[model samples]
Target: MDVKIDSEGAFGSAIVTLEAGEKFVSEAGAMHRASPNMDINVESRRKKMKVYGVHLSLSESNVCR
Candidate 1:
């Protein structure tokens, strides 16, 4: 994988190139565009927490591949 970043002022963009069978992971809403040949998958991870004897579920992160 190859990564290039360009920035102007406070705005920036990244260009990523991937080889076959390689995967890239990023935040769910970070992607602006993708090539037609790229396959994308979104995954969400959740954690179980117990606070004050109460059970709670929280999302850890959203990853895109």
Candidate 2:
């Protein structure tokens, strides 16, 4: 799924393109409006068997600031 957070850095809209054989059974949403500093929750169909590093992909707004 591709989601773009709003310009206000609050809520976001997403274009979920699931894998052909995969399905999104359920989802939980909250904080329709929130700032950039808000905590973000992430999920995946599979569990992490080992610790992985995080990659930073900052947008122009957040990066340039």
Cα RMSDs, all models: 11.6, 14.8
lDDT per residue, candidate 2, 1-65, as tens digits? 34544444444454333222323332434323333522333443444664333222323344223
lDDT of each: 0.56, 0.35
- Model 1, residue 4: distance off in Å is 0.7
Report lDDT (Cα) of residue 49, candidate 1.
Answer: 45
Q: How much lDDT does candidate 2 score?
A: 0.35
- Top lDDT hit: 1
Candidate 1 least-lDDT 10 residues: 50-59
TM-score of every candidate: 0.61, 0.24
